[model samples]
Target: MAKVRRYSSPYLSDIAGGKVVVSCQRCGLERRYDSAAMIERAGDVSLPELRIMIARAEGCPRADNVYRDRCELGYDPECWNGTRPKPTDVP
Candidate 1:
């Protein structure tokens, strides 16, 4: 089987203070990302650019809500591998 990929949205806005909303095309999951944490991880890169890079790195295409129908049927290019790290596994 082919490997599944994951992706995130590039356009980020402040839904609330200190937290930014992020959309995952692969899983259709909307989650909040810590802006400060992201800035620290992507020093020198703009937020939008960093979002795009992160999405592509995870194998998701930069698209809009126009593809929502397709994404519902699981046609998303970015799919998760269904794995999670346990507390004991954390370094």
Candidate 2:
């Protein structure tokens, strides 16, 4: 038998081996990211944080007011392991 790893969190390092994908229902956009690369650039940020960062980088209207958090970033089912943090879940 072999041990298996699970990515039950939203941290970049946790999902590094699997696909790091996020999609926005409101914006109608989906994006895939290189987890290793992102970790190098931004350390191991949580999905909520990453959502805000992506929203800002991609010019999402809700990026300006993260408290309202209209970015709606959700993990694609193909790589989902746990309940994805909502936009307002950012720290």
Candidate 3:
């Protein structure tokens, strides 16, 4: 008999406001949620849960389009000394 590993879905209650943002490593499109909207929807739902729902509704995983980088948590590879752009001072 073989066992299968099941993955659990992320919920809104698992994240906080001002913590969720969308960024694409391929296109470098970064976007953040509106603070006003977060406040308005903070009564009965969590930001992470809402994001997951919206991702599903949009037919994509937030981790795929929004946080597709080193990991689902959005850790930039360059930050860890990987082959990416490094911060530099421009004249």
For all predictions, the C-alpha RMSD in Å is 14.0, 9.9, 10.6
Question: For candidate 1, lDDT tens digit of each residue in 1-91?
Answer: 9533233433222211245444654575554445556566654354455555555544554432344533221211121221433224569
Which pairs of residues collide in model 2?
none
At residue 23, what lDDT does model 3 achieve?
46
Best by TM-score: 2
Q: In angstroms, how far off is 2's CA in candidate 3? A: 31
Off-target runs (Cα >4 Å) in candidate 1 are: 1-17, 24-27, 61-91
- Across 40-64, the per-residue lDDT of candidate 3 in tens digits comes to 5653354445544444543554444
The lDDT leader among the candidates is 2
lDDT of 1: 0.42
Which lDDT tens digits does candidate 2 get at residues 1-88? 8434344455777677555778888877777677778788887777777778887888887775756655677767554443565344
Q: Per-candidate TM vs. native? A: 0.37, 0.65, 0.32
Residue range with the least summed lDDT across 10 consecutive positions in model 3: 70-79
- With candidate 3 superimposed using the best TM-score fit, by how many Å does residue 71's alpha carbon deviate from the native? 14
lDDT of 2 at 71: 63
Native-structure RMSD, model 1:
14.0
| By TM-score: ranked, best first | 2, 1, 3
